[model samples]
Target: MKLQLETIIIFVQNINRLKSFYVDLLKLNILEEIPSEWLLLQAGGCNIGLHKMGEHYPNKSEGDFKFDNNTKIVFETDQDIRSIRASLMNEKVPMKEVKTFDNYPYWLCDGEDPEGNVFQIKQRKV
Candidate 1:
């Protein structure tokens, strides 16, 4: 038996806000959405789904962003990583500087989604 990766579901506090962040800021296409419930987006070969968290979930809105998460979603891009980083920063999205190691052949940058989930964008060095 074989299983293929399809979707990554993120439990979120505000569905619309996350939807806008992925759709408008990240430029992901929506595959399916149920208003304030669940949303599925086209993220290249895989899909990203945003699920509204239950009322019992704790809301973290009063502290500095803790980069303590274990998972980071990455998006490959053909454009310049610096421009992408700058564009996201213009929208107030917390983004890190584009970096590449001495032997690395790809330029990469990391940023946070509206809900503080970490995401990275990479462009192959030409």
Candidate 2:
């Protein structure tokens, strides 16, 4: 048996804000867009689905919806961590202070998506 992650969905108040942050600022490609309701973004090998809460599901109460910060999307690769960090900095992306653990390096950045989701970009030590 094999298990894999196909997509990460985030519910946001404003779809355009999230789209600009993810697609324009971060340079993520847009795979698909379902009008003003949902958008599918390409992130590495996985897909990120952003759904507009109030616009898509009007029947549901907006008060019932909440943003969850307990989970995070980690971008892992063999690319040089320092170089990647530098590029993001140059682009003026707001990132948390870089930290190292057991010689493994990682950095946390404020994704600035409409839902305020946190995105972590890291490189494991070889």
Candidate 3:
């Protein structure tokens, strides 16, 4: 038996801001969007879905859904790590300093979306 992952839904406080980061900054193509409600983006083999928090979820009050600090979404890239880091910095995206793991042969840095959803950008060092 095989299981397939279809979409990853992230509840965010601001839909437009998160969409802009994925579309404008990361350059992920938009598959579909519903203003202030939902957005689907094409990211390689998977689709990333962003839904406005506390709006569409049933039985949820305003400010009920919050970004989880323990959740980290990672995107792997084949591009130059330094170049990607520079681009993110230029966009004023708050990011950690790019670093190499002592146990792994890759360069990685973390950044956040508008509402503080954390994500990591990583590139394997050649």
Candidate 4:
């Protein structure tokens, strides 16, 4: 028997805004959009789903929502760190200075979506 993770759901107040941030800004491919409710995005081999939350939801607020900066979605790759950093910089993506720890390179960036999720970009030595 084999089991694999298929998706990770991130809750949001607005689907359009989330879509724009994930699909347009981050350049993630959209797998499906379910009207005003949800959107499924392609993140490598796995999927990320954004669910729209109602005002009654416990976490919903009148203004913009804030996410825990400590929570990060890491995208791991063997791609060149310098090249990736250059490309992201050219696109004006807000990223932290690259740092090395335990012989690995990593950079952090805010996803800039409506929900304010953090993304950790990691480049493993090849």
How well is each residue in 1-126 modelled by candidate 1, as lDDT tens digits?
122344566777789988889999999998877899988899987888787776544645424443444445667777777887888899999887788877767787777899888777878899
Number of the top-ranking candidate, with TM-score as the measure: 1
Better of 2 and 3 by lDDT: 3
Clashing pairs in 4: none
Best by lDDT: 1
Q: Tens digit of lDDT per residue, candidate 4, span 1-126?
A: 122345566768788988889999999998877788978899997788787875555653324434443234556556665666667767766455667746333433223333556465555555
Candidate 1 error regions (>4 Å): 1-65
Error of 3 at 52 (Å): 28
Tens digits of per-residue lDDT for model 2, 1-126: 122454666767788988889999999998878777778899987888787775334443234332343344656556766676677667765455556745334443333334555565655565
Candidate 1: clashing pairs of residues: none
lDDT of 3 at 81: 66
Q: Can you give the lDDT of residue 78 in candidate 4?
A: 60
Worst 10 residues of 4 by lDDT: 104-113
Per-model TM against the reference: 0.49, 0.43, 0.46, 0.43
**lDDT (0-100) at residue 121 of candidate 3?**
75
